[model samples]
Target: MKRQHSMPFGAEAVHGGGVRFRLWAPGVATITLQLDGDQELPMTAADGGWFELTVASAQAGSRYLFRLPDGLLVPDPVSRFNPDDIHGASEVVAPTAFDWSDGDWRGRPWHEAVIYELHLGSFTASGDFAGAIERLDYLVELGVTAIEIMPVADFPGRCNWGYDGVLPFAPDAAYGRPEDFKRLIDAAHQRGLMVLLDVVYNHFGPEGNYLHAYAPDFFNPRHATPWGAAINFDGEGSRVVRDFFVHNVLYWLEEFHLDGLRLDAIHAICDDSTPDIIEELAAAFKSVPGRARHVHMVLENERNQARYLTRDDFGRLLHGTAQWNDDIHHAFHVLATGESDGYYVDYAADPARLLGRCLTEGFAYQGEASTFAHGERRGEASAHLPPAAFINFLQNHDQIGNRAFGERLCHLASPLAMEAVTAVLLLAPQPPLLFMGEEFAAAQPFLFFCDFGPELAQAVTEGRRREFSRFARFADPAVRESIPDPNAPATFETCALDWSAIERAPHRAVLELHRQLLLLRHQWIVPRLAGMDNGDPRLAMPSARTLAITWRLGDGSLLALLANLGDDPVDATPPPGQLLFATANLDATTLARGRLPAWSVRWHLQPGDSR
Candidate 1:
């Protein structure tokens, strides 16, 4: 093993701006600036162990590299504009050059947001930022207020899931470069859409990750993650590591103008500090100058700890925003499809549980036994939160693609069942999220993809097969071959949205249902659902199989959602409100009578519409 120096990244980038440059070098003492190959500027060091350089007109397109004190060269640690490839020197980009037309765009609240998670490559046949731009109009019409893009940070090769990103500042060369991404965001904002970036701070990808070569202790040996050594959050020189990540957050917000960040897998972050790394990052973002609503943090944490969303403990939430609500997805999937295999064991086939989780408690597994994990987890109940505290989704990259084989909700159930699921997802109290191609029930699967070097790629391929073989019936290696070869171009190509699906019948029906649901939510729901009670909105679970939700609007117009999670249809009259929305077709007589179909969701407006 080779010894590497840790570069102090914080000392250089945080200097109150005159184009001060910073790069982390743990193993080296001296560093030089390689400005476009010829000009070498000496970098000074702060007493706290960091290298810094100040340059004029250090905006965008200024190509530069860092020469380690020992003679090795590397990219800038805080390169806001990586016009060069990740493995190459850094290129500067002026964050302020792009004309932003969204200064007046008021954000959609977390409670009201319908998030559509997408990948730039797989989102369209073009598989680039430009290609994704073509579909923004479709998303806007679909009723989504925010578009959560998968990681755009640069990685090795042309295709990846972005968790393995090594260059935090650069957009993948495969995604048509940096300005293309800006086009997408600017276009999104122009259409009244907020963009949430999916950020991976837990670990970097395997290939093209040279951070260790420059900063050895960037990862701590005391704690370990499944991928590799954990980041040094509380260890020696860990303050610099914290600053590195905090800088990344601010860079994305300040440079890309991204509205928010979805921090990937916070539970795996394993920092045992008093003011946890997450809290520190959150506090830093919250404290940034002129960041009112432009920057926010959303966590994808498996821990059912409400503190991830609550403001009660540690004030972590003063900076934190919301977490991905897996419990809601679990309960809804179990109830609708009756699939109780993996984590679904914690859930039962009950609409009431699903409704209750979203309406009142915000999670189905708060202080409950998890059969899949075979443990008693989630010991406390977090009921006193707002509806916006959770981000609900039927299919995310993990849920649909991480299964034994990538299988979507559309594949697991019938068309009607899909419609019912979509109804609940949209009409639920919390905000809803749609995975890429989900609006039309896309046939393509979002397989786990990576662009590691050959050995790592082989390891990932074999590992994916072996991992899924344990619980899955697909034991044959031939069957495992269907798991998309992540590095292959097809992996990215296959995931693109087949807009033609919208013209098909079942897909069109589902698409129409989504459109209608969005209309109903914006037109009738947002006005009624506001404020916090003891918990979130109270989900009225009526029985082992029925969920009832009533939203009393500000104008006294009650909106109620009723769903039958059972296999058998339940014939019951809805509460005395006119039937405004129903997953299944309800004749006027049936609407008046209120007979709900099996596994169906219905929305009813309270009587006295004028009120």
Candidate 2:
């Protein structure tokens, strides 16, 4: 008996037997397959930049490389399976094979999601996908509805922050094999939790990249990025370039059944092509059969443009569901920690700006001559937006790790300071994100890590030092020494979760504060505050800088979230409504005359029946 095979690259799953590997190199004369351990298999070219090789021996855990005629035995430029890069071999995974039990799970609506961001390589001692699965129950129990895993796209070697991934479709081998990742997603879904994988499309990593050789126009000469030439979105043969990424996006959703994606640094993706790649990709994602409803795109950009979050001129969203509200994080961080340098220069300790972020979707400084950038910064303000259209986070991978020293918010400020900040963030009318270990005041810093070739390694080190030199206070030798060495073993080792600390006293309290806060939000806030359309003005008393918002849900319940970023107390009179829950440390005795704590957050729910 003989076995029949389909097209090499786009083969469909039959009896789940073997994989037919393929590569496209029109410019080259010949191609060779570098199989596991020095075994080279010659390939036969068909036509139109395509080559095919079918071997029944190519099963799970097969190590293979592409041998170009130039004698370059590089790993598959688009390798779906990579085992040897970290420790083992790449395995072929079938998406249809996994039995998912999440048929009853309609993911939590965007407004109700509280995202927890984590880096797989530094999250645990083993630092892999499997390690993250072990803690999913804890997240669910803690009231986290979604896990926004940082970028796991393939980088050069074993460890990375994942913003510099080159292989867009392949998961980093260091994290675990692709199947292991599928299992992690399956396990998360079974628990009624959603998984959002971070992806990088702006640029490739500095090392282990070879796509340009096959197609130089894959990058644009018209525009350039700090990393390299921008992806060929507007260049010649850009349709294929766009197809490459569009396919990758669908691959994760359709192939791995990932719930959503967090795109890294979207502002850097300069595309001028008509029917822009962004919109085209959005349409393509919507075309997927069973997976269309579950996919979402989260962008990280300095621009708070409304069009990115809203529909196009014809009433269509441009492949984006949410964007990081940098202004909100900056305003709260500056007021809480009082460290103003680098990009923080534009941020002030103004309670008005903080209040504006709560009421309006953006800050007053939106494109208004930022002191930090020395240029006009701007954002769009419009009505066609839901509250969940913005993702608010006080501390993320960039906020804490990009500092001169890898110091978390806990190390930079007091626990009380963060507690007050958390109050507003959790109770606000937007999606809030908690960095890993932040819920418990985890003190470890998320230092930058990479496994690049020696040349790239030296470049990275020098570039990092040069970057810190921009801050005069951090330029001094002593100050430089104080900054944790990004490459040091201790930097990576210390970032792991201290499981025992969660069972201790002060740490337990911090963790409980987060858990209880989230529980209160889920049980009371979200159910009452979502989708309110009345012309209720955001409450801002003349005497206080903080702003209060009141909205009536469908269930005839009214909820109010107060945001305070000032030093003095806000003696707010709650519009003839009774207090349900207050954080001013005052009970019913002084509720009317007492003031909210300095830099505090308070949430009060007044039912229609209450006086």
Candidate 3:
């Protein structure tokens, strides 16, 4: 089947024989279309500062640019593909050209999602879409239901985390062409794996964004993000701006046949209008005619707004499908690593209690004041939300890559501690996410890497080191200077996963632990997740580091967890249920003795009521 998402802007191949090119250059009066560097066609000025031109000779693979009123030329803002990078000409892509074989793939349910987050550039040696496709069978064997790829939108230079993407519509040429991405998604669907793209709607990259030059109204100066002026979602000329991003969402999901999208750092998206941009986007996605397709909308909102994750009376999603639960990660990190720096301070004093809270309630800081935020209150009450509304993880891109050394949990925590947390994360009712190399405990660090122009490169590198200066470890100027330069080629190269490590000794053991935990989750937990009620579960802290939680599953069965995340054993009364899995070779006799081992986790399940 041929898949295509038709949008108002950008170049679209006409049926008769031609390509229609349109641009929204409200900041400029006149615009000229430059095709193949030789033919220059004057576009007709239409209402709302739009320029339109139709060329019968122009077809797919035609490279074109727009000449402003001045002598300057710029690539299409909504380009389908910029083969020569962001500063080059935009290539006309026939979206319907690629044939899809997964016509019956309606996507898996959210409850079944075991997301594996990976960066396309660092996921394999090829660092491209086709290379990622080769690893599909491995992911399936690892029991990952969805693969959440980092952003592939066109950005400046060769390598980036993709948050710097400027062209929301075009896949980065560094990761192969748009069709190659389609094949990757197609291949993943064939292997019964859902593909989710990480999209950045909050802000554009630091460079190569030409919107300000031709469409100044795209951003509002009234509000500013850490990057710069915020996107104009509520200001004058905001309608076009909102539509641009809304269409971009439909473009990826419809044209590429993606299963879902994870919006990046949505807290920075400043929208004050009624039924804000996020609401509108979710509504638009829900309105699409696909009852059988389980297309999810995930978010990374630091605000922890539970209202967006609300469901209908019948347990259908009212808006977003889920959110990345940072609270859970922070609590787990503090317990395992015991490093109370930065945001870890919030959970340091009583990490075990916070971890228990997160296991029962959706968030630990529900309507609570944040000491790290300087007394500013953070998060809404999330107890009413189901466990599926919160996606928990021990490590993710931001958690690992943001560190000065980019240390994974394996680098800091003991193997027993890591195994215990892994068991808790994977076997929990909430869907779990694994970073690229976490399953095998690959030694390579996921450093912060970028490739910008010389001028911006130096600034970015210096700024990156300066960010860690606030910490005591990097207090000395000499120590901070030793941090890897983000613009360095070695920095980017070192982040690539060493696939061979999975076959090695220590790495093989870690991989086995993850595989077994995921297997138990799929067999014993996922079946009881559907129709799970939303509310607080029974939670208790029997000791300083021992937590016991019992959740009533949808099947009316009671799933319980007894964890001791400490260096010493503690006295505890185990919850009543049959043991399903345990860490550190824990057994029923040891649990029946009312003594929980250090860094141990036990999962138990009681059969549902017959009535």
Candidate 4:
């Protein structure tokens, strides 16, 4: 039988026989499969630089690697499981063998999504798939609709942020077997939680990246990314390269049954294709038949391209996608901490104005010349896009981990400021994302950590610390040695979230506060702001540090939230029917007194003048 055009690229499990192996090596003349340690089976050449061979003796979990002409063995680029890491044999996996319990769990709508981003390695004390699975209930109770897991691609070594993965098709062996991750996702889906994986497509990691060794055309040497060679999307032999990436997308969604994928650093993806690689990828994802629910795909484009969410006049670009709202985070960080340097300088210069604009205009630098980028215009006006297209977050992996010490917002900013910003984030019309341990205000720092060879490791350490030299923290002579080495096991170990912290005093308070805000978001705010534009959500900054956003509900109820983000006291008169919520001391009677305490968030509601 001819292979199904989309039946994945590597190994296929035969129904009554064994495993059929497929290898794409257009450049190589002859290919041999080293099977079951000793037996060598020569593969027959097929179309499109493809070679295939079926060994009836080889069963599921059997390991093998393709042998090159010079006699070097390499794991399958599209292997579902690499039992012995990247340098070892790739195991034949039957993706359909697992019993999934997420029956008919057609995921929630994007506007209703409250995403919690987590790194599986550092999210739990065990730092594995099962460890993360144990926390599913904790996350569900926290009222998050989506769990955006950090990248899980099999990279070199035991610990990593996962972006360095060369194997796009396999789960990291460090996180346990591929089935373990499936179990976690199944469990999450059983609880009505959507699982979204963060996928890196711009460039493969430097270490253990042998794609060039076999398929030298996989990467276009013409372009470069921060991570090194960019994936060839428009150059010669780019068609197959594009198919490889697009195939991975189909495999993740169809095989793993993941609810969605978050594309990482899409701005760094240098593709000159007419419709754009993203549009092509989106079309391929949507092409899968019998997709019941919305397959939510979000993007982290530094350019803040809202065009991804909507088609153009010529009916191009993918529509209904969400983009990360860095403007909101930058404005919040600057306004909350009052310490601005580096890229923060741009927003810090006019924080109040930028914060106001971020709330109202979507992107503060929308089509405006970026002073930080040396007069380069950044982003496009996306205020016309639905507010849900903008994902708001107070802290994400990049923001917290990029810092010299990886000190969380709670560590750097006042409790009041954090609380106020938290309220703003959850209450905003945009869908909100929470970093792992952020809800409980976990004290553990989320430092950048990785595991690489000694030589490359040293380079990473030196480069990481050097990048932070501009920061005031790294400037302190005492702090230079304190900068956590990215390559150290200790750095990876320390980033694990302390589950015990939730039992403590202020941490407990913060957790409860987060739960309440998230519940309020799902129940009241999201429904109220559903399909609402940025213009629908009204904002007022009474002072440089005080902000109030009012929403007129469809049910004729008015909801107003005021937050004081500064040390000084600020006041806002409540339009009272009742004071529904308050992050500080005050009640309906106190709210009626016409003043708000400094550094506080309060919600006031009047049943929309029921007359």
Candidate 5:
């Protein structure tokens, strides 16, 4: 975990003048650095695989590429800017060019985070950071404290989920330049919004990844991940690769001025050694300076490892961090729509009990043998973890886009059911994340789309069919043809949200519902979530499909969300309190009788009651 004190590997501007070029290429007989407007210079050898050269006349905004041992010119592996594209030369970016005005912004605590996850490509028609900047005020108005952007790292194609990003350090060329991206961050901070980037560390993209050419040991040959070879965290040459990634995390926080990071699929990052890369990353990020030091670190892990989500005695996730709670989504999906297919089969068996458990415990599995994993025991004991440690969401990028047809929950369930499920999502003590366009119930379907060569694209199509073959819909050839080609431009274009719908009905109603609910959350729930943990369910009613959670606010008022998750209506007989909000349009007599309609919920506030 020792920090390297030598010059950085990529092209960096020296303190006085010019740029210092460095690369890590072991076993190479020769390595050369070629600037855009300058002659090719041979790099001097340092330690194992390390090559360095300093050009006293190198200027900013110039492009460069490294010549490999075999004479193949390759882009810098840790490039800051790739002006041409992922497969082209890397550009020199002056990091201090943009003037930031977030001098006094310290950011809100993690518990108070209300995340809005959105893909920059699909967030607006322009599909760039500059376009997203126009909506920062809209997000602030929508009550989202943080914007968890999907991966923006440079990938091979123009259209992708960004999971296939090859250059981890370079922003996507499809988006505006690095300076434009920085302007978006600066604007977001000015509008009182935190930006959390989603980073992919599990595997590099299949195409445009040239790390193996320069550093053949960057990936572990023995270990395979879902996307490809596992990163060489504990193997030979791991020190360089591990340090490379650790420094990248710090680089994003420090250089980009980001408020936090949401790590993508860490469970796929297989590391069997002590002080795992996750632990290493968390510790490194915690040690960063400025706003980067106390920035948020979130994980997407299926294993439900609550140990990462737990805070130390000082209430800090210094060595571990918060994880996405799939248990809640799986359980809620089964309860809301009765979709028992695929992974939903496990929770469908006893959805009420499962949902209740997910509500009470941070993880529903918690070392239990999972039928989905072929009776293999998964997860660890996590009943002691806090609710804030688990992020509950009804629809995220995967939940909506990974389906056979990429249908939203609004299309799957009844309107009443959607609202009811949303209450559980927004009103829960756990941090809630809303996917873009869901607040307004946009009709766009976020299908899995990409752009690749015909051969690889066909292979991906066939592979997708094989992947979804487990579902009955994909079992038919006709349905498979209608499944939308991932490489088609139309597939990506269709996912772009139709912002016009927000000004219309039904959508406006849904949007207003979200606003009201979030306003209620900010006014009631977030302040009272302190010291709340798993197995501390103040209200749990599995059999009746009902729940009542009461909490005392900073001013001593009690707030609660009384909910009915089932289709059968029942007499709630709520506690004596003032009715603050209701999901359904209830009449006065119904409110007086405390009658809960099928799939409905309500919020109540008691001014003087503390119990």
Candidate 6:
């Protein structure tokens, strides 16, 4: 089947022949279309500062750019592909060029999602889409239902975390062509894995964004983000700007056949209009015609806005499918690593209580003052939201890569502590996400890496080191100077996954543990998660570090968890049910006598009452 989303802007193939090229250059009076870097044609000016031209000879594979009135050349703002990086000419790609085989692929339900987040560059040796395709079977065997790829949007240089993407419509040439990306998605779908792309709608990259040169109204000076001026979602001329991003969402899902999107750091997207950009985007996705096709929308909002994850009376999603629950991660991190620095201070006081709340109520701080945020009120009550509305994880890209040394949980926590937490995370009702190499405890660190021009590279590297200066460990200037340079090739190389590590001793054992946990989750938990309610779980703190929680599952079964995450054994009564899984050396006699072992977790399932 041929899949393509017809968009208003950009170059589109005409019915009979030729390609129609259009550009929104409101900042400029006249715009010229430059094809193949030589053939220049003056485009007709239309209403609303639009320029249009039709070339009967121009077909697919045509490289083109726009020449401003003053002779400056810029690529198409909605470019489908930029072969020679961000500064080069845009390539006209026929969206229908790829023949899709997953026409019957309708996507998986949100409750069944076992997401594996990976960066294309660091995921494999080739650091390209084709390289990732080779590992599809491995992910399937790992029991992941979805693969969330870091942004592939065209950025300035060859190496990046993809958050710096400028071209929202084009896949980065560094990760292979647009066709190669389509192949990755197609291959993933063929293996029964839904592919979700991480999209950045908050701001453009630091360089190579030409929208300001041709359309200054694309940003609002009134609202400034950490990057720069916020997008013009509520200001004058925002209709076109909003449409540009709205079309981008459809473009990825429709043209590439993607199952969903994970919006990156949406807390930075500034918009004051009614039915804001986020709401409008959600409405657009919800309006998609196919009822059987499940297109999930995940968000990363630091504000912990529960309203975005709201559902209607019929349990139909009103906005986002889920949110990355940072509260749970912080609590779990503090509990395992016992590090009370930075944001960990919030959970350090009483991490066990916070964890118990997160297990039952979905969020730890519900309309509570945040000490980290200078006592500002944060988060809405999330207890009304289903557990599936929150995505839990022990480690993610930001958590690991943002650190100075990029240390994974395995690097900081004990093996027993890691194993205990892993069981809790995987077996829990909430869908769990695993970082690229977390399943096997790969030793390589996911360092912050980027490749920018010489001038910007120096600033970024210095800024990266300075960012950690606030921490006591990097207080000394000499210590801060030792931090890896983000622009260095060595920094990027160190982030790549060592696939061979899985064959080794400890790594093999970690991998096996993850595999077994996921297998049990699929067999014993997922089938009963369909109708699980939001406020169904009952939580209790049996001891300072011991938690006993019980949930009424969708299939009328009761799933229970009794965990002692501390270093010392705690007095606790095991919930009455059939024991499903437990930590190493756990005995029924010890549990019956009200003594739970250190760093131990037990899962039990009680059959529903047969009326």
lDDT of every model, 2 decimals: 0.72, 0.70, 0.91, 0.81, 0.81, 0.92
- TM-score-better candidate, 2 vs 4: 4
- lDDT tens digits by residue: candidate 4, 1-611: 01122453688878798888887787787789999789888899888778899889998889899998888888899888897888889998766667777767787777778999999999987888999889999999999889999999998899899888979889999999888988898889889899999999998887877767678788787888776678899998898888888888887887777888989888999998887789888887677544667687788888977678874553233643688889889989998888778889888777867776776667778888888899899988876666667788989999999887899999988887777788878866678899999999999999998888899999988888777776776786567767888987788898988899899999999999999888877777766664344435577788777777765554556677677666776666655556556766555565667566666777766665352
The predictions' CA RMSDs to the true structure, in order, are 5.0, 3.7, 1.2, 3.0, 2.9, 1.2
The estimated TM-scores of all candidates read 0.89, 0.90, 0.99, 0.94, 0.95, 0.99
Better TM-score candidate (5, 6): 6
Clashes of 3: 0
Best by lDDT: 6
Candidate 4 Cα misplacement greater than 4 A, ranges: 1-8, 311-317, 472-478, 533-535, 551-559, 575-578, 585-590, 605-611
When 1 and 4 are scored with lDDT, the better candidate is: 4
Compose the digit string of candidate 2's lDDT tens values, residues 1-611.
Answer: 11111223532333456667777666677888776667688888887677777766666556777777887666665556566662233345444545665555445556667899999987777799999999999999999988999988787676778887776767887888777888898789888788898888888887767766655667887898887788989877686678777877778776677778887777788899777776677776677656425567787877666666775555345567778787777777777778777777776546455545544544344445666666766666633455667788888999887876667887877666777777777766677899999898876777876666777777776677777876888678667666665555566676777777788877898888888889888887777645543314355543545666765553556667665566676676554444445553545654655566565556777777332
**Pick by TM-score: 1 or 3, better one:** 3
Alpha carbon lDDT of residue 252, candidate 2?
77
Alpha carbon lDDT at 519, candidate 6: 95
- Model 6, 68: alpha-carbon shift in Å? 1.0
By lDDT: ranked, best first: 6, 3, 5, 4, 1, 2
lDDT of 3 by residue, 266-325 (tens): 899999999999999898777555647989999999998989999888998888999999
Instruction: Compare candidates 2 and 5 on TM-score and give the better one.
Output: 5
Candidate scoring better on lDDT of 2 and 6: 6
Pairwise lDDT winner, candidates 1 and 6: 6
Native-referenced Cα lDDT, model 1 = 0.72
lDDT of 1 by residue, 390-474 (tens): 7888889888768755678888877777777778778765778999878888887777776667888888878887776756667
